[model samples]
Target: MSQEFESIWDAIEPTVGDALVMKVRFKIMSAIIRECRLWKVSRNIASKRLNIGVLRYDQLLACDIASFNIDELVVLSLKAGLDVRLEVQGA
Candidate 1:
């Protein structure tokens, strides 16, 4: 699913699923950036590790959640030393 959104609320398909995914992606990105800052991790180093531009990584670190897609956030989170996991439970 290509989530190349112009705004955080933007989506490829205006469906509930897309919106939920966007919010989850935003939260995940926020958590990664928060942890990175807490650990004093340099954005430059993270960018190098993620093979992304320093500015782009800086944006990620700045909590610019709306600027990134789901796949990009996942990659950034993994490179930020975070383990990605999914869970399912009765809802």
Candidate 2:
């Protein structure tokens, strides 16, 4: 028999809460990456704009999710000129 998951995080995370956190982090990271692409800026300039070091920005570009927490991603998103919003849905 096989089991199916709605998301990759759901299958990988140990619990629902952990999966939710990863999902949120991925979304924020995605938005930041998108903004970076749209800005068409070099890594050094982009990192400066986002107020992060070049290496940290490289980690983000590489989608190194384990290196970042929700709060840090949120702050970085803001510095990238993204308008962050939260919506809570009942499960």
| Per-candidate TM-score against the hidden true structure | 0.67, 0.95
Against the reference, the lDDT scores of all candidates come to 0.77, 0.95
Candidate 2 per-residue C-alpha lDDT over 18-51 given as tens digits, one digit per residue, 9 for 90 to 100: 9999999999999999999898989999999988
Stretches of candidate 1 off by over 4 Å are: 1-14, 89-91
> Residues 1-91, candidate 1, lDDT per residue (tens digit)?
6546666555544876887787778778888877677766576766787789999877877778679988888877888788888787896
